[model samples]
Target: MADVIKSLNLLETLKESIENNKLSDVKDAVEDLLISRINLAVVGDRGDEKATFINCLLGLGPGDDGSAPSPSPAAPEEVACYLNPKHPDFRLWDLPPVPSTSPFQPEGYMEKVKFPRYNAVFVTFTQTPHPHSVEVFLEARSLQQQTVYFILFTSAKDTEKNLEEKRKASLVALTSHGVSLPKVYLVRPSTLEKLDFPGLLEEMARDLPEIRAHALLLALPTLTPTLITQKKESFKALVWAAASLSGGVSAIPVPFVASMVDSSVGVRILTKAQSSLCLDNESVERLARQRGADPARLKELRTCVLSVEVTKGEVKKRLAAAEKEIATVSSKLVEMAMPRHARSVSRSFAAMLQALNGAIDEMAADAEKIMAAALGKGK
Candidate 1:
């Protein structure tokens, strides 16, 4: 609730600046509001499986022969850290597996990998549990700063029965050591298609702190309908912020300047939504190609990528079309003797909000269409 209030206040401040023709102040506020980052650590003893899972999560396609190095059991000390390409702010740290033969002090192991600073950690396992990993999870639970954990079962079949058995066995092993478990997910690293993976992602989105949850949602690939819906809801949560920013432009004293600023703000909001939904040209093209879509159709889809110029043009066109309706209402208000300034500000605010709402709706629909086409549900 505090965060909500803070966000509202920030949005209002942004609106007030726009109303005052404070372009620099508006830019600064938008920059501050938009800054977000998330740090994630993947830990497990099966180094190869862990690498495969991380690669798949990043949409790097197992990376067996690609840029992402496949971790080998022989090199248990090798660690990889990189920002997710789709979301530069999402930092993923692949911690090397703790060798069973090495010293098994959980605190020492965690410190060795510098895991204390990560926002969230995923402990991966296979058919059997590693005693050292279980101990590390227990230690992690006791840390001064709370850390989110997801117990991942990698390189597994997608059947619910198999997943449940593996999850139960892992739980039993952890319980034997007096360790309470966090959420567990069974993932097939090869295909990244699992019955529970979406649920796991939803739980993470629901459970993590706000900033981290927002970053995670932006970083995730649109692999399932549930995930796509979650992305939409996450974007929807920011509409008020966008609308507030638009309404702020209404206060600008200069004629036409407020509308220009509103156009840019609308573009920014829609672009952010497009990126968060993974509907950018590159993502959509790659997904289409992978789905065996026709070459010409893929080319057509790529052209639908969101752009600032296009968004601005659309907003201007819509505003022009709405002017007649606004004029009719304004004339009625004038006959009632409403102040001209009040009527002008009302028209400007309405136009700005309408433009933003229209842009968001169009971008969301494009994202859904892309997702459907990729999933073989679209023409």
Candidate 2:
């Protein structure tokens, strides 16, 4: 309960900082909430398909083949770690299958890989269920670990009936071994957008709400409207933190210095939000190129509103102007009446909060517009 109160106080401080335009305080607040790492493990027999699916989630293209290792049947069970370049906190582990010819038991295999360390484990298979994979899943359940049984179809063109039949057979296989059927997801590596990809992500988020902001926001593709909305909502929570920090900084007796600090913090928050939403230059350029659209158009659209640098510049300009006005009023009040000076300072804090709120609203709206344009919805 004490920890919860501390967290709430920190969030309140962050929100106040953002509202008061105290940039440095907002940065401190945001840094406090940034997740260090979220561990996800992919356990499967089909190494090639598993690697391909992992790469797809990382948004790597064919040219980036070596980004994830595709282990073959003949190869040893080596664990490969894949981190999202944009959000390094999300770590995906590709765990090799337990060899059929190996003398070691399933429990030994689990211990070798440090299975309990993972927040979520995915047991992937193609066509039929493998006994070794089922053994690993049961062991994971016995350890009280969160696990998902994933079916990756070899053919993207498989009909719904065929997919359902495969799912039933997989369940039967698990039941035959006296193991309960785990949450299952059917996916086609070639057509990830069509299947239970989003559902799988939502399930992970539901199970691990503490790291949901980093887990789902970083791993899930931004091709769908639902994903974009989730990204926005995740960032919105940070906005309050930023605002609280800004407001706290405004209480300082120093005049111009507080405003300067606020400008810098605001820039960092906006930049972080841009990256989190996958609206950075690299992501946008990749999207434009993929859709056969001119990358220059994205730049043009960004200049109008979505660009973080542009937003930062505007925020600094406005804050600077406000600071000058506040300084003049403060000087007059200090000479004539100290009470008036204190009141003026309070008003300035309120004004800064209002301005910051407008800036945040504009940036969020621009982010949405940028996403729509990337999806080919906006001309």
Report lDDT (CA) for all predictions. Answer: 0.58, 0.59
Query: What C-alpha lDDT, on a 0 to 100 scale, does residue 29 get in candidate 1?
Result: 41
lDDT string for model 1 (133-169, tens) is: 7777777777743454545555543467767787887
TM-score of 1: 0.74
Indicate the worst ten consecutive residues by lDDT in candidate 1.
333-342
List runs of model 2 lying over 4 Å from the truth.
Answer: 1-29, 32-36, 46-48, 69-75, 102-104, 147-154, 212-215, 218-220, 249-261, 289-294, 297-312, 318-379
Q: Write one digit per residue (lDDT tens) for candidate 2, span 1-379.
A: 1123333444455445445556565554356344335677887764567777776666554445334755543345677788877657667788877666655478888888888777777777786667777777777777777644555555666788988888788777778876764555787764465577767766665556443434445344465556655555555455444444344444545332454346665665566656655567776676665556677676566542435454766767766666556544444433332223233344445445445545555655655666567666333
lDDT of 2 at 338: 20
lDDT at residue 78 of model 2 (Cα atoms): 74
The global Cα lDDT (0 to 1) of model 1 is 0.58
Worst 10 contiguous positions by lDDT, candidate 2: 333-342
